[model samples]
Target: MRIAYLTIDNINDNVILAQTFPLLGRLATLPEVDGIDLFALRKHGGDRYRAYLPPTRIRVRVGNNHGIWHPLTWLHLVRFALQAWARTRAGAVLIGRNPISLLCLSLAASRRGTRLVLDYRGLLSEEYVLQGKIARRGRMHRLLRRLERWAIRRADAILCVSERLRERTVRWQPVAAGKIVVIPCCYDPRVAGRDEATIERLRGELALDPARDFVLAYAGSLSVWNRPEAIREVFHAFRQIHARTRLLLLTGDLEAAQASFGDEAAIIIRSIPHEEIQHHLALADLGLLLRDRSSVNRVASPVKFAEYLACGVPVLVTPGVGDCPDIVRREGVGYLLDADLPLSRIVSEIRANRSDFRARCREVATRYFDGDAYRALYGELVGGKAFRRLPESPSVGKACA
Candidate 1:
């Protein structure tokens, strides 16, 4: 069977999608599955255009440029729906984060008797409110919430990145409880398994003195939800405990973050290519994920946590948000800080348990965050069975062979 995957974001730049691509590549090895076609609607000037095939080898089609605003985006949605409806004979329509695209894809797939799986990566409306871009009780927020509810209700299945998000979505759309599935963002073992030499080389290149200074690293978007202030707190605590401890931040918003905290840290590397992330991870002694306690963050499942574990780097995370604390606790991989805990206490704990912490990190990645398990989960979701027997080959068409 053929499936049409839809997205509105810059699919090329999204790390979650890139990580999942290998799983999709593996799924293509299934004997019973035909193929997975990606349909993306992108912006171009004031008008939208379509491309039948993507520029790269990735299985995707780019539709004509759609205007970024309301009515034009809706028109592009209708056009994309028509195209997807006409192209795929029977299977599933996998909808990504776009609410407008989900609505149109739902309608198209319903007409063509195709199943719909909605990938609600995050609560967009709630995210907007948490970012202070929109007021939670305002007219626009209420309207978007209504649309989100409608889309959730319409989906045949809902794929959430975290259990917390699944719970929240079910609470909002109680009817979707049985339909919801949790598939957290995971680290691809291929990316996670860099050689020791490569890692050491990266350490040298970054000028990271592992013997002299303890490294604290944070990688990903430098957004408000990530709580830059928490980094400051951690650094302050580190200074009190160990004068040589250094903080390193690698993020997309380098200019803004630099403006905020560049002068404070001993070393701050701005955003690097996603490919270079593992190198930084390898150089780090500790990983930090300290999010603000916003409603959006409460359901966040950050990919960085898994990456840290995969690289055998211990993490220091905040509790009461998403599954990070639970996973860390269950796997014995890292420490979880209560928001009310004094920064000094946190620093003391880290300093006291450094050796055990690193060991826990290795154990957790080996046990729970195994890439084989992640591949099997994706296979089950898409092919209705595990992919344990699948071979590692680059044949894109063999996924559903």
Candidate 2:
């Protein structure tokens, strides 16, 4: 069957490349898929996505996304819908959570008996509200929630990034629970570990003090949702215990990072290529995946969580923020650090299990980040595993369960 997959994220953005593109590649490469037409809301980087598109079987279209509340944004989605109706006779529609896309695809799917799939990473309205971009009771927020409800009910299948997120989506349509599939933002196994030589080379290039510094790195966008103050607090706390520890920020939002940490005791980096991030992560003894425990963050499956694990870097994560903490605890690969953990205990945990954590963390990452995990889950969601035959490993199911 031909599938028309759409993401609300910018196609060429580092975020999409990390999570969405790998899955898109998996789907497009399948023999049963005659072709897959991918639609995106924006294009941040030039020519990054072009090399990945298989010219014959996969086609892509991206639209304007200048402002979130802009009327033109809605018009752009409508235009994408129109384009989809005109250019593709798809049997299945897979969409990332964008209300306008949902509204348009509902109409498009109804006419063609197209299977509708919702990739509900997090509730869009809740994300905005938690980030202080919108009021929970405001007209736009309520309207988007209404649209989200409609989309949830209309979708033939649903994919949630976390199990908690799936439970949250059930509040919208309890009957649709049967169709929901848990597929977290996964990591690419190819870049799982970096050689010490390469890591040391990069350390020199980036002017990092390889011998003295214990890099505590955070990679991904520095959004309004992130607690930069909290990051600093934790870094300082960790540093007080382990004097060699240094905060490393690898982010696209340099301005925001600077504003929060202006020439402070941290190493700031511009957004590097997604493929190169794993190598940089290898330099970090601990990776940071700290976020506020709001409704949105509680359900988020941060891609960086898996990326860190893939690079054999243990994480210092906040509690009750989706599956990461549980995975960390179960695997003994990371620390679920409280804001007030004592310095002595913190230092002991780090110094004692450093080697064991590195080995086990990579093992746990292999189980969670395998692309086939999502491929199998998607196949189950769409009612068949016949579409793609990637080898199924039992370890992932065990790890996630």
Candidate 3:
């Protein structure tokens, strides 16, 4: 079957490269897939990500960026939907990687017999309300919620990032239960690991004291959803007990990081390129996946959680951030930290079993987060029959259970 995927995210966004592109690449390689047409909107740095696209069996189109929430954006998506419909044979799969894409693409998809897939990430309208972007009872919020429901109802399949999210989706729209497939935000195992040389190099470059300093790393944006203030509070509390510890913030928004943490001169905050993130992550002894206990985070799976584990770094994650706390406890890979909890005990535990944690974290990451592990799952979602035969890198990782 031919497939056409549309994402409203900037083609250059880390989400596109880390999650969407990998899924697309996996789909393109499936024997059941004839070819894939990927539709995206270009902004600055879009060409850089374009270079990473699969060179065979996939064609890409990065259209002009008219800006999000603008009227032109909807028109652009409508055009993308119509284009995908016109180009593909009947019964081709049309996937919308976000709510906006799904809503617009569904319009064109309904007119055709193509299957529609919703790449449901989280509670979109609720997220906006939490971020203060929209009032909870406002017309825009209600409209967005309605459109989200409509899109969900129209989807032939729905890809959820967490089991909790799938549950929530089902509760919100009972019809979604049968169509939903839980696929967590995964990481590429190839570049994610602990390399001795990389650790040494980054240690020297960042002036990190290997003998004295215990490193705690946080990677991602300082966006409202990330709760940058909560990150700071956690790091500060950890730092109070472990005076020699360093908090490393590897973020894309350097300016925002500076604004949030610049006053602390001892903090190491850098905006490293996406390709170099794993190397920087290798320098850390512990990764921080702090999040508020909100509805949005409860059903969300942050990619950073997988990334930290993939780099052989155990996390100090918040208790209710998606399925992370359960995984951490089940695998003995990390600690579940609460805001009110004291850090001395957690610190001692980590110090005592750092090596064991590192090894176990890598093992858990291979089992859960590796993209290779999810190939068969992706095949199931896309209705591709070659999943069992899909190429596996025996040296790299194992298939998902």
Where does candidate 2 clash, by residue pair? none
Model 1: how far residue 312 lies from native, Å? 1.2
Instruction: List TM-score per model, in order.
Output: 0.82, 0.89, 0.91
Tens-place lDDT digits, model 1, residues 265-384: 486666776666776776777799988777787887777887787776788898766878887776666678765656566555655776677667766665554545545555555543
Candidate 3 lDDT, tens digit per residue, 164-269?
Answer: 7877788888987667767688885445644778778778988988567788899998877787888888778778898988889999898888888876866898
TM-score of 1: 0.82
* Candidate 2: C-alpha lDDT: 0.72
Give each model's whole-structure lDDT. Answer: 0.66, 0.72, 0.78
List candidate 3 segments past 4 Å from native.
111-113, 384-401
Q: What range of 10 consecutive residues in model 3 has the weakest lDDT sum? A: 392-401
Predicted structure with the largest lDDT when compared to the true one: 3
Off by over 4 Å in 1: 41-58, 63-75, 339-356, 383-401
Instruction: Report the C-alpha lDDT of model 2 over 1-401, residue by residue, as the tens digit.
Output: 77777666777776676666677777765656667777787736766777555335677888878766778877877777777666545456556455556666665675565677777788788877876778989998898888888878877776677767777777757876666667778885556757878887988876777556667889877786677888888888777777877777888778888887788645555566667777788778788888877888888888888888888888889886888888887777777878465755755666666677778888887777767656555555554322322244321222121
- Model 1 accuracy (lDDT, Cα): 0.66
